[model samples]
Target: SQTIHQWPATLVQPVGSPLSLECTVEGTSNPNLYWYRQAAGRGLQLLFYSVGIGQISSEVPQNLSASRPQDRQFILSSKKLLLSDSGFYLCAWSGLADTQYFGPGTRLTVL
Candidate 1:
């Protein structure tokens, strides 16, 4: 029974502040992890992904970065966030079949 967890389900931050979002999976190992962002009424945009620990791939070059510090742990961070960075952040894990199972997303608002 694999399950994904994300923290601080909703956040409101000032512009130019730092951001840190974490995602971890239970009951799985070496799963392909991904980070996605969706603006209000927009489609999900792939941000980053990892096939294994310490192996991260960026799909979009933006103000954000991701790291896999452990087998089932993924972290998304930003040194300074932009107003455009506010959105719904989703963390997902996929198996060999490539069907992504998402965690409850984190909603961010920048003011």
Candidate 2:
């Protein structure tokens, strides 16, 4: 069965702190990976996405970046955090069928 994993389920950081979130998929190869941020009670916003390793596309211009180092591994990073960055971060992957399966997501709170 295919599965997705995300780390640091919840986070609390002061303003200007560095942030890193990881997501990986099992039982799949070269799937399309995506990063999304959702504000409380708001719709999901696409942050970044990758069709293949080292091929990343940004949908929103913000303080965050994403990298795909491996076929099934995607990483999201920020040099510094902002108060507006507080939200739910979700990692998802889709196979050839283009059906996205989301990970458990990380909740970020910036003070």
Candidate 3:
């Protein structure tokens, strides 16, 4: 069975600070990795995705970046975060053999 792991569950940060979030998968190889954000009442927005190691695609250009160094490890990072960066972040994965599985997610608050 495939599963995803995300941490912190919640976060509070000041504007202009740095940000780093991690996600990892189990029970699959070369699964498509994704980073998404959902606002208070907004739908999920894809921030980034990775098809393979060292290959990342940015869906929306903003203050975030993503990377996949290992077969199952994905990371989202920002050098200088903004107040608009506050939201619920989710890590997800989907393989051609399976449907997308989302993690518990992290609620980020930027003040």
Estimated TM-score per prediction?
A: 0.98, 0.98, 0.95
How many pairs of residues collide in model 3? 0
Superior by TM-score: candidate 2 or candidate 3: 2
**Number of backbone-clashing residue pairs for each candidate, in the order shown:** 0, 0, 0
Candidate 2 lDDT tens digits, 10-59 = 99999999999999999989899999999999999999999999999999
What would the TM-score be for candidate 1 when compared with the true structure? 0.98
lDDT string for model 3 (1-111, tens) is 888999778999998899989999999888999999999998999999888999999999899999898989999999998999999999999999567789999999999
Against the reference, the lDDT scores of all candidates come to: 0.95, 0.95, 0.92
Alpha-carbon runs more than 4 Å astray in model 3: none
CA displacement after TM-score superposition, residue 3 of candidate 2 (Å): 0.3
Candidate 1 vs 3: which has more TM-score: 1
Candidate 3 residue pairs in clash (backbone atoms < 3 Å):
none
Model 1, position 54, has a per-residue lDDT of 97
The residue-level lDDT of candidate 2 at 71 comes to 94
